[model samples]
Target: MHGLIGQLRTTPGGRGEVVAALVEGARDMPGNLVYLVAEDAEDPTSIWVTEVWETEAAHRASLDLPSVRAAIARARPHLTGMGTRVVTRPVASLGA
Candidate 1:
């Protein structure tokens, strides 16, 4: 499976907007397995995303669409810094 993990520091009052963006991503994307999140207790805006895709190409292809760009832009205003990494790993079971 192909996967992406991202970490982001959110600006003040950005968390709500970011969450809305994530929800849109979930609703719009086609080949995504899941988008899991973790938030910092001290800072509501500090967040991480662990996203699983059926294939890397599918995720990359999604980026070319205007809707995906718009969804990403929705969170841009709230993001202080972010990083994403893609990985390829063997599937051990259907659980993955």
Candidate 2:
């Protein structure tokens, strides 16, 4: 399985909106096993996203999806910066 974990820094107090857009965009995506969004405990404007997919190609293809494109555009205004990101090849997982 292919997976990704990333952190995003949003404009002050804007994490909720960004997270909402991301979640909405990911809905019904093919090959998506997991799509989880989390808020940082200490940083109100920081959001973390964890995703698992059946294959790397599916993950790449998601970027071209209309809902994903729209979500990115809608969330752009509130994005301050991208933080750390890491790609992973998952061997096993409980949920995904």
Candidate 3:
């Protein structure tokens, strides 16, 4: 499986909006095993997203989806900075 972990820092008071868009975009996505959005405990404006997919291609294809495009557009303004983006090969997960 293909997986990704992204860390984002949103504008002041914008994390909620960003998280909302990310979740909405991923709703009912095919090949998506996990899509988790979490807030940073130490930083109020920071958010983290963890995604697992059946294949790298499926994850890439998700970028072209209409819902994803819309969500990206919606969240763009609130995105102030990005921290880390790491790719991984997922072997297994309890809930995924």
Residues 1-96, candidate 3: write the lDDT tens digits: 999999999999999999999989889778889999999999998999999999999999999999999999999999998999999998878842
* Top-scoring candidate (TM-score): 3
Evaluated with lDDT, which candidate comes out highest?
Answer: 3
| RMSD, one per candidate, in order | 2.7, 1.2, 1.1
Order the candidates by TM-score, highest first: 3, 2, 1
Which lDDT tens digits does candidate 2 get at residues 1-96? 999999999999788899989988988888889899999899998999998999999999999999999999989999999999999987877743
Which is superior by TM-score, 1 or 2?
2
Candidate 2 displacement at residue 20 in angstroms: 0.9
- Deviation of model 3 at 34, angstroms: 0.4
In model 1, the clashing pairs are none
Per-candidate local distance difference test = 0.75, 0.92, 0.92
